[model samples]
Target: MACKCGGYYYTLNVKASFDRDLNKRRKFLLRNVSVIRMFTSGFFRSKWRSIAGKRRILRLKALTVSLKALKLAGVHGIGIEVWWGIVERFSPFDYDWSLYEELFKLVSDSGLKLHVALSFHSNIHSNNGKGALSLPLWILEIGDVNKDIYYRDQHGFSNNDYLTLGVDHIPLLSGRTALQCYEDFMLSFVNKFESFIGSVIEEISIGLGPSGELRYPAHPFGDGRWKFPGIGEFQCYDKMDDLKMAACREGKPQWGDKGPQNAGCYNSVPSGVPFFEEGKENFLSDYGRFFLEWYSGRLICHADAILAKAAKILKKYQEREQTSVMLVAKIGGIYWWYQTLSHPAELTAGYYNTALRDGYDPVVSVLSRHGAALHIP
Candidate 1:
């Protein structure tokens, strides 16, 4: 069958043998199989089925050839990354969905389910050595790069980091918070592809942070640059972070006006110190716990902002179209867990095998409250 969308047409072909093979496997397993063996087989079979489904989704960019291949492999779903930069590259509220419309039509014609990943940052390598920004260049031009808008690394370098569209700056258009602008983008996205929401596009994975993973830029400084000390240093020391710290220290005059840095509270050593000494008073204090929670709370706020906007959009669509569409939030795993410099337990009391030593519960709590699925990849 051929599907047409905005001056483009594609044909879809499904191989019949794939369906036959799936049925054959199912029947073979059910025929006089032992209960334990049947259960084990079923569990592994489901896992393989999910893996195949995701593989098919990830190959959606290949178009007709991919659809045919996925069908032959007994895969029924496909995922595609929709670049925010490309979609709204020209200007705010000005979008071109020609490419996506074509892809959706192809998926619909192929009778396959779809998952859409909304990517706001790019890890694409360019000639400039700075990773490509998934945000529109014009948006970056409006923000103050010198401020805490962009992420900085352990060495206080901000060269290679991608600018976060919703967090790092004010919206290009007036009278809108960054969160509201992001929500408006989601609404526009759903409106543009409204016809396919409940049909072909079964899920929308919202990109809450860099590389579509929900966490701070753990290694934002990039690889082989600054080696981490005995304990991983938090990189969110920009003006905005400093402001947040100031707020945390408002009632507590004992911590001083500068928060952790005021009293050499970070890593149990004074600022500019490279390493922490064992059995130091600052090291044994609850400073690490307070910092962990403070940093984690900041991350959770960002995650909440994005997820809340996404939930609002999904709810609007559900009510308007009378169909359910799933929302998925991608959570990044512990980026510093495997560091060879120091064991996480030895470095700080609150450290763990999670992002920035901040546990995943805070992020997960927001996702659960917003009715979004947690995707840890």
Candidate 2:
């Protein structure tokens, strides 16, 4: 067990069992208790009233009284966001899984343990602050706004001014990409719940960036018909980040010969930079550590193709239910904006040394090579 928040650090693992005929009748029979500490939220926004059109009903006794008040407040786990614009809202390989089969049978009859965020963008916001376009309006009426498919920033804004979906026009309108439609929507949502993803679905956050958290969209909002004010820049000027900064300046020629024209290297102390004056090295802290190692190697190649398509659909449901399943990749933390500036001018800030060498150690070293797990609120 381990814990530490606001700076990040969480590790928990528990296992226990007993009862071999009560240990030869000595009389102490506790059997099977394994807890991988997880207590999430997002509760369930009722698909945000089906993206505001309303009438999507599914009040199973108010969702079994809110999963029996999160199993009497112990809350083993619950995170559910699964809204890809209300499960393929109005076509594109049609799908509806009837409100995730009644919220996974009321979260497996309230025994809890289910964490799925898959939400293809839109972390909600709107009240005038923006963000709230959970995509799917026919993927912005069949996209292609000149290929860079959204995400512009550097004052130009884009991402159609908030909400989400435009992570390169979702793999160019599904002809595949956007990590192959997130590994075909996690192998059609684990083959449409093959026995509750082989036993009460444990985790699968994988939302990958912008609110769902990874990076980019450090604030966007431009075409919801204009309305701006501080915040809204980082998005590394699209065109696949200008062909990955022209292949990282063709083998790093001091990242010069002209490259970054906008994506404003997260403003590393601009305005006559001279903070850590004695020897200089700023240039937006070396292009924000080469744009956070090229955006954490393109989000670790889309989290290794979404855990290799969720390990080939959890290996055909663990070869017809022999049991034993595990597929993680929650990832979503990164907020250190130089510990909120100010102090000897935040000790000559470079945005906390570009969030510890380009945003949280290159996204926790490429999501720890794949076992991935992080949710720092």
Candidate 3:
């Protein structure tokens, strides 16, 4: 029988322990790389030259990095995180590519693929990393200037503005409606880096919450210091209709309707309950359920959306450069765990188990299982 979070009918082969065999593992990986290079080089040469070449190079780098990182850590698998705040904050206009460029290269060089966590909050953009994790500054700005559509508060104590997820105007930060900004962001990120990281980085992790929901307990004011910008007005499911309408007007599909729908908001035990009423255990149980539904329901949808984007962009890059490596989504991280800082191991494992029972695949195994078939786009 398949494990709960083990989504597929097939088992992804991963070594249970690193002490099994050193030289044998190296030999196996080497053979895999050689085969991948040969196959990608042949297929991607004529039609998708650029994308194919880039994918191949990326694939090689990703393999090298994953292998190296595991060796350094002395483990067969290591956790990798992609700070979303870092990527999205550096938007296309004012973004700094060098930091990521260098870091990704290091990862590739290290032979470690990242089990990335794409963040939605950015302290740099808010100029308040000290406060509650705020919406990326770009998004706040968009909601601020474009129209008075966001849930806004003028009182100095709590000036946080909340925007309903599906109803808000185009994402101020993304300049597109609701979830459209997220999709575009994914496309742009993949397209820009496909030449570098696409094919090589096989597994990734993503996070999602109540539509435009950034963080729970929208802490706008506490003990005279504001934690988040839009606390009092934090809008969530109340605005789905607006988001769908906006998407229709913009000629985009209304994915919001088809995506996972999180009902009751849950708070975390250690993270301090929102409204200062719901106790920690209550928060955990309720929020856990909320996350369970949201993640499981949208697992395939989210995976398919990102995979499609990656495929499109990879195909383009392969046509141009003919590299071999593929970026794939394995499992998503639980945002609820973000507030619980003490025992990441326990929290991550708990959520991992939860996802397994709910029918999502554990990320590490996905790569190992599909290791052979995965190659340049």
Candidate 4:
């Protein structure tokens, strides 16, 4: 097929080209041909056949493929991922923009948008900090190893010394102060990419860590600990209190008010610390915390925050340019979604039922309407 632009014509070959000038040509192909094929692949060929069910499943698959391809090609807005340790490593006034810059540049050059997984721990930091994916070992000196305690708990999971020191639990506190450091990192992120972010990037996903066995005890609410339902509930350690005081007294803090907000937090929910129990039942009992937290907190609250922030920022940015980008949140796993994360199957099933009650399908539909898709396994 071919499309006419004014007086010129361009060929439309599904596999051969998408460079046509008229957006209609591409849109037509996607609606008619691409969607039908995807539907057939899942519905007709598969034994689980029901006309209505097939239609729904087909729409879902088409949507999934379309969204993934669009984000990858930059046709869509952007997709986000998390990389927490990076920000924390140079937090409190400094930043390492190289990692993000590289990613942004590649996306920009390709005419695609970007969404950043702001910050979180990675395998490099997980495997004693010497593995292929480890953060540049230098962060050990920069980041307060003490705060790294978030990694270890009775849950048998280890996010800190286990990676850097080659052992599971090792107390080595000493790095930047807390709130100041965290704010510094966030500010640096927002500032460094201030121009490129809302302009070129679509969303930013802040990871709380995975819901796997390696992480537990850090559950934000259900199990207590650092449960901050609102800024008022936050426990102000000496450093955090000092920062608030300094910001209030000096009148120079970047974060307005220099204090916590009434907005709730979802960090304490899933520890992402692993459980090394030998039996499946024990593992389920331990890992169940993550499954529940993922459904209740991570997918609901944390994901909502990312989307709301992205929408607010992107909308304001677009107001000037008269162009709006979609806000796609990189959310956590579902019941089945966590199987790959090594969550117990029973826990996964339980989460699935919870998802049904929580209106997960509708949430995904809402995201689709907004030019976004909540990730699933």
Candidate 5:
């Protein structure tokens, strides 16, 4: 069985807890980092599906027992995904934490700590096309009208999985920027959960990009356009024309509207791939240099803006509570074609990292300022 969220799958492999001495010493600055693992559970799937349009926690007693069992078995805690779609699903700024409140209370009573993630992405359907959780309806409605708000490839195909980095600061979300929407979600959470911050909550993971990780959906599945070993298409552009191109298209009309064309397929031999080939005059060309830089720069700006907002909000809570409420940001792993000059997969995933250029440095430098730990999921 697979745990699916926002068109991605995760395997639970947590094998340890946050160091007890570190927790006790409050030496968060010592910065001995541990990976913050999370679980979504079956609760989300069945919670909203009660009859008569009602939402209920099915088998409350059983859930209570399970939490107690985990506590007694020496489990550390659980990661509760406070979904943007569910909380503010109906309209802007109207957050509903009803189900999460109950779950959190149960975990608290069971004496387990919490690793909370503000999941700002959607969950796609199963193979049977039954699952339905996704971005907020209001946001999706706007995307329906202005397709440029979401990320798409050169083929004019786009996804509403998560809003694209193209429109992070764009005032398209009913007069609110996408970054504002995310910040508001965090502000509401901090204000709502004051009672649990230092006591039960260990860390707050802020989702910065797709699948709750800070990266473009470069090699997205179910689109039939990508698969393993493929170079993956650039997701910086949208399906719309004449709109502010997501990656910007001014003064470079000669570069044309399309992205790198001869790039390798989802599964291609490194030898025959023209775009990624050495001295191929495609990826190393002036146009490739320009587009890749602009594409990746947009992503970095998105991350920088969001982290600045998040650090400001969450750091205050840490000061008031006199506890270390760490902020975590996740970036996807892009290791394909590392041996090549282009590093096609990395470039498409909002990383300009390659033999010719150092990309992660700039992104990590931004993270260091906000005291955020980056997790590669």
Candidate 6:
């Protein structure tokens, strides 16, 4: 039975101080870039799918009227996800911005600002394709040829939610690295929406990893493969050799090729869990320290690579716009594992946070270098 439970819903669509003048609106949108969850302008909402559900968004007339209402209600503007799957569904570098362009026009005519999320991941895992978008067909075709492009866990459970960081620089997507592909896609977006770059489009939420959050698809919900409260596993195994080589060079040759097995299976609790409980073989051990550091470090490297390219691209646009265009990156759902000393869940999910160390500091430092506002929903 499909649940038609629809009533009031939360939306990131909050109207900033309304400006009737066109130029004034542009400046306001550009200068104010703290766009965050539910009216931050950079939209980081989750409780509600969107103000206009997928079905209504598909209707042009409905979407047009929706924008008008938003403007009337004093909503500064709206943020929409430009899904890679739909835009570049046909081929590489081939983008069709017809729909979004029309949508942008509606916002403009209604005197509202806009922020676009350069969404790169599929929404399949969240709702099992209940009005969800899939990855680009062509890219998935390549994944068929090389499965490692997607994150595969030890139990051989493959999460096709996002591309693994291990293959970020490696050329697997038709002679182009994943990073290159993303760059190309973003470049195409800026070019396509050049008119709205500085004016209406004030902020861009860059999708760093799965579901646009900076984390591995360790405990994925797609197909119900992983249950909640379960310690997830390491993803992007292609980078294992690099970690192994580093370990060997660090006078820990025995650690080569052996990832952390102390992490219990999905649904394992903190108490009595080997790697989770603070004990001899737990995260307090010497081996644990090294492994977790390396694990989180790799994640940061991936963020640095993507955000470096993204920052460069946005900076050029910002210069052209002659206004401060805010760039945002999402790192949502910080775990509150106060019960476990080792924090096995965070360790497996690529966060080395525990009683001893702050795993997020280094990651935040990297984001700071790029001037990206972290959106925590």
Choose the strongest candidate by TM-score: 6
Per-residue lDDT of model 4, residues 84-161, tens digit only: 444334433345455455445645655555545544344542333342133324445433443333333323233332
lDDT of 2 by residue, 275-311 (tens): 2222234323555445434544555555455555655
Predicted candidate 1 versus true structure: per-residue lDDT over 351-375, tens digit per residue: 2222233243344457666767655
Per-residue lDDT of candidate 5, residues 111-216 (tens digit):
9787777888875621224554678999888877888888887667887778887667668899988888998998999898988987888777788887787888
Q: For candidate 1, what is the lDDT?
A: 0.50
lDDT minimum window of 10 residues, candidate 6: 1-10
Quantify all predictions' global Cα lDDT against the true fold.
0.50, 0.47, 0.35, 0.34, 0.69, 0.69
For model 5, what is the alpha-carbon lDDT of residue 263? 67
TM-score of structure candidate 6? 0.83
Q: What TM-score do all the candidates reach, one by one?
A: 0.66, 0.30, 0.40, 0.40, 0.82, 0.83
Model 1: residues with Cα > 4 Å off, grouped in runs: 1-62, 125-133, 143-147, 159-176, 221-232, 242-278, 281-284, 316-323, 335-358
Segments in model 2 whose C-alpha atoms lie over 4 Å from true places? 1-81, 85-88, 91-97, 101-103, 113-118, 122-137, 145-149, 152-211, 217-235, 238-377
Cα misplacement distance, residue 305 of candidate 4 (Å): 6.0
Scanning candidate 3 in windows of ten residues, the lowest lDDT window is 39-48
- Rank list by TM-score: 6, 5, 1, 4, 3, 2
Question: What does candidate 5 score on TM?
Answer: 0.82
Q: Give the residue spans of candidate 3 off by over 4 A.
A: 1-70, 76-80, 88-92, 121-135, 144-174, 178-180, 198-200, 210-237, 240-307, 314-377
